[model samples]
Structures are given as structure tokens and as C-alpha cells.
Target: MIQVAFYDIAEESLFDFAVIIAIKEGKWILCRHKDRRTWEFPGGHRDPGEWIEDTARRELYEETGAEHYTLQPVCAYSYLRQGEKASFGMLYYAQVDELGPLPAFEIEEVKLYDKFPEKKDFWTYPDIQPFLLRKVSGLGIK
Candidate 1:
């Protein structure tokens, strides 16, 4: 089983990835990778010496074309696989004010949803994503 933990302090060097849960006009923004059918939030690994928050912004723009937006850090989180060391990441909430054409990046498509779909088949990382979604929802995002 994978285990997830939340920490109050976001130690910059410890975080390896950044993910943004974006909202545009009350709807959720999601992305589909060019190589995968499942949907996921815009996120990626941190570039060397890049601030974690910048990682979220860069990935969000690269994957979703969100040119204008306000981003807020939600929390710092870590997940541990059964045999691997814990991997740390920072989660963010983005209120997108504008979007341009999708960039020709790794993502194939960007979409909006009134609410997260109930079907588990829609997610790229089923087990992990649901937990992340629930954490965001707990913030009263809706």
C-alpha cells in the first residue's frame, strides 16, 4: 500500500515534484498526456535549483496554457511506496483567470469539468489522485 503524509513546513530541497489543482470559473481544469488516455492535473518533477512553486507554475502553463492565474500553496505532502523511500511534493490551488492555446508539450489536451467525475477510470493515478482531490476538497474549494 502507498502511504501519504502531510507536513506543515515545505522544505524546499525535500520536495521533488509540484502539482496544481486548478479552477477556472468554478470548474476544474485537467489534462491528458499525449501518451496516456487517463486524465491528471498539471504537474511534473522539479528542475534543478528551481523553486517548487515555480515548478507548479511552469508545469501548469506548459500543460494547460494557463497564462494568467493566481496560485496558492495548499500543503506539502509525501508519499511512500511499499519498498521505496518517501517522495515529497507540494500541492497548489490555482484560480486561472486566462488561458491561451495549449502548448505543443507532453500534454495532448486540456479540459474543464463542473466537478470531479465519479468514475475511477478517468484518473491517471487512481489511488493517489483521489486522496489528493479529497484533500483539496477539504479546503472548501467548491
Candidate 2:
């Protein structure tokens, strides 16, 4: 599992983070490493010189070999880790015209599921699933 930690303490909270749900042809794209077969959305820590949207695009392309996609911010949420509070994530919805081929770096394999798979097959950040399901089902954000 990827565990995020906060090393710096600030008076106020930090609220800048990003995640992307890359959707292609009505299916969502997820990636996993060889050792850990559980699938998750393609995302990571934002780089020093990149914007959140750029980070989402870069991660999506780097992990799934996907290009030319549209991204829209969906929602934001906070979570606590190791007794410290932090702005956990800002989730985005990405619509891709084509999925292309899988990129060799970072990602081992790409799995596209039509609907949210059984939770047993993978673990995801808490806020991701509901928004994704809503988007997939055309129900809008719940």
C-alpha cells in the first residue's frame, strides 16, 4: 500500500492535491504493479514545477499510454494519516477518446473495467469510488 505522510506542520491546512479517473470508451483505466496485483487509478504526488491538471495528464499518459483526454475537477476531500491531518485528495474526471497502448514505464499492466469491480479485487482511496460510479452511471456527483 502507498502510505502518505506529513512531515511539516503548519498553522493552517494545505488543500492542493489531485487525482484522475481516466475513462476511455465508457470503461475506466486502472493500473497495478507486478508484485501487487491490486488495481488503482493512475495518480501520484505533484511535481515541483507542475500544475494539478498537468500532473493528472502526465500521470495518465505515463501510466497508461493515453493521450488527448479531457479532464474536469470533480471533488475534494480530506483524511487523517498517522494521527496527522492533511488535505488528502482532489479528484478529477478524465474522458479519453482513445486508450492507446500501455506504456512500459511505471505501470505493469492496464485493466479497464466497465463497472466498479468487486472491492475485494482492489483497494482505493475512500472518496474515489462513489464519484467514479456516479460519473459512469450518468447520475452526476452524489
The candidate maximizing TM-score is 1
Each candidate: RMSD: 0.9, 5.7
Q: Give all TM-scores, in the order shown.
A: 0.96, 0.72
Alpha-carbon runs more than 4 Å astray in model 2: 1-16, 119-121, 124-142
State which candidate has the highest lDDT. Answer: 1
Flag clash pairs in model 2: none
Model 1, position 9, has a per-residue lDDT of: 89
Which digits, one per residue and each the tens of the lDDT, describe model 1 over residues 42-134?
A: 999999999998999999999999999999999999999999999999999999999999999899999999977778689998868878888
lDDT by residue (tens digit), candidate 2, 1-142: 2334323232222335556777787777778865676777877767776666677778888878887788876655445555554556556778877777777776788888786656765755544445444543563422
Alpha carbon lDDT of each predicted model = 0.92, 0.64
Which pairs in model 1 have colliding backbones? none
lDDT of 2: 0.64
